[model samples]
Target: MRGTLVLISLALVVAGVVLLRSKRPAWYWMTFGALVALVRIAFTYNSVMEACGLTVPPSRLRLMLARMARREVPPDRPPRLLRTRVTRTGLVLRLGLRPGQDAFDVAASTDRLRHSFRAYGVTSRELRAGVVELRMTGYDVLKRVQMPAKTERDVMRVPVALRDDGSIQYRDYRQIPHALNLGATQSGKSVYQRNLVKELAPQRVALVGIDCKQAVELAPLARRFSALADNPDDAVLLLEALVGRMVSTFHVIRREQRISADIPDAEITADIWGLPDKLRPVPVVVVIDEVAELALWANTMEKKRRDRIITALVRLAQLGRAAGIYLEVCGQRFGSELGDGITMLRAQLTGRTSHRVNDEASAKMAFGDISPDAVLSVQAISAERPGTAIVGDYSGGWYRTRTPHTTLRQAVTTCNDTAYLTPDLPELAAFRPVLPPLTPAGPPSLIKPRPRPVTE
Candidate 1:
């Protein structure tokens, strides 16, 4: 990977130089032609200097002009960010490179450039070319990079420098099992979650929501969910059942594994429904609303509940990666204040996103090390920017994305549209919430959509 990335980075340099040299019109070339006088003087002097004994040839010496030209590109077009913003955390300058320029080349010349960028306050990873192909990450060194929130996108959706194809060149959720979503209340947190859930819902993945807010938050989309947990006690029981189900499925996979040797490696994986009926291992994505609620217990019973839930979450975060059991844990706050094991739980989450938060501390907790400046942006999030958010998957650091709102009605509609696609699984069916059946045990009657409330 390292060798491949380095070669790709160098190629970008050559490509960018070609593009930049070509993009200019004749007048610029005329200006370049004027420099021929100075070029001849230096070229002649260098040729003579090497004539006696110097090993470095004038040909190699001429190539040095490209190196100098490469460095000149940045000083010519310094990014137009606020000076204070530029001097803050992990990045120094957010200059735009030519379409094919490689950031790794710039970063490699002197760790000083990267170090200086970080020293002077710019922190987000350098954005590189290839935006369409990577969808999120395109740069060799920038795969782990993140930039500041200059625009709404930077604050809401992570700007993945892809190859302009909308396709991801790197990892996606199917590959990363755990996602930690952290933001202060009203930080567009729910908006982000809705976008993710909206995408996965139609894919036939069994959606399980743990909404301890009496299911009020996620209840509207019950049509799409295979299970929803409302209160603490019920959520505890539900989670335990999920763990039990996982244990059983693992056993099934193990028994089958004896012959898995005969099967392809691709077939060895297990999910909530992929196990043979024998091993029904369909992938399970558990959406937890207010993980703090589940992790915090007021009493001994709640503590035990918290312990069990934490244990299950830890297991899922640790072992579920291969089993296709993914987690989407959302909360207004996730910190050491929640007490034991919360930090551990947060560690399990590989992907994280934060909307505008109430304070820098919350942002720091969610995005501190990877993006402290991003945390600063999170504090400014308000209701007006409902669908916008900051998403950091490390797929390309953090990006501000405006996740189009997936309203309760829209979600219900989408879920219903895709409900039939949800294959029936006996184990999953056992966990479904009993909603007292919509027909009320009477003859079938026509139903009407509830009318919306009007403003006075």
Candidate 2:
């Protein structure tokens, strides 16, 4: 009982200190705290008396005096550390940071904090300069830590964190196009893809989807997709065509290069930004679902396809930047064992999004080498929230994000509305899977004689 009471006392003290450490509240630590201290000391009195064998009866007032004897003195002023902010867009959030801290440190610490708090439906990133952006992950535990700080935004871009001027902070992700998404099944891996697709659907970018899962998962968003491939064969074909398109596009820019003093400064570059509206090249965002499946084949024919696929993927990762071809590859796990190509591939993808995973390895595969605490955070993601994820990109840190559930129906509807945006590319249409044609039924089987009359 004595030991238990002592532990409780220490805990209470620590809790109070931690709570008051940041905020500027003097009275809270003074008057009200003094009263609480008195109550706590009085309870400790019985133990003290029992141990010391004192004759004096311990009273609340006496305990109050004892409490003050050991209380820590208030600091002169609170430490003026950098301030932080949280902003929301739908279920996604953006985090902003203080000036002194580097983005990496803040990102790592934020990853630890997210782990401790189990910020499910929470994905945070640091923006250019000193901002952290977050996307709400799909999970329930996130509600516990971030509920009080939440501000809802229905738009695609969520300025989750704030600036010194209290304005909405944002970042241009196009600056880093290659992204790697890693997580185990049922851990919100799929949710990240959904979020990206939803964000890019309305953009002028062309969408290329490679779903090794027979397109069953991505088919709903077909209307927005310029090309969708199920098998590695089709994926390879699609990539080959995409690569050809990129080369041609680059050549056109090179051939058309006629920089002059009359040209606007922004138009001096060779990228699509430099072109006229009609001739502007559409950026292609390639999404790979279950990339491991693409690497699993072993036969000679399969090996050839895999080699070509890896080479093409690497080319996109290496040189696709200038060509406006970005790759967003999603997998259950990303490891070096997949091949030397894996290491090369991981380098190109600057953005990383990790949902909850089953093991430490999965987390490590997703995040290069996260703190043990952050790895623990991945395990905390529950299966109930299918759309919640934690995203870590090149800029800041791992963040909790719960991408609001936009059903397949919703995605389909969005795509169907903008189907006209589908580019005119005959190569893509040639390999598209042929849906079965509906056959007309002959006039009732029992009335077959009617057909004979027509023949006569």
- Residue-pair clashes per prediction, in order, are 56, 39
Model 1 spans with C-alpha error above 4 angstroms? 1-171, 259-280, 380-383, 394-396, 423-430, 436-456
Which candidate should be chosen as best, given TM-score against the real structure?
Answer: 2
CA lDDT, every prediction?
0.57, 0.60
TM-score of 2: 0.62
Count clashing pairs, candidate 1: 56
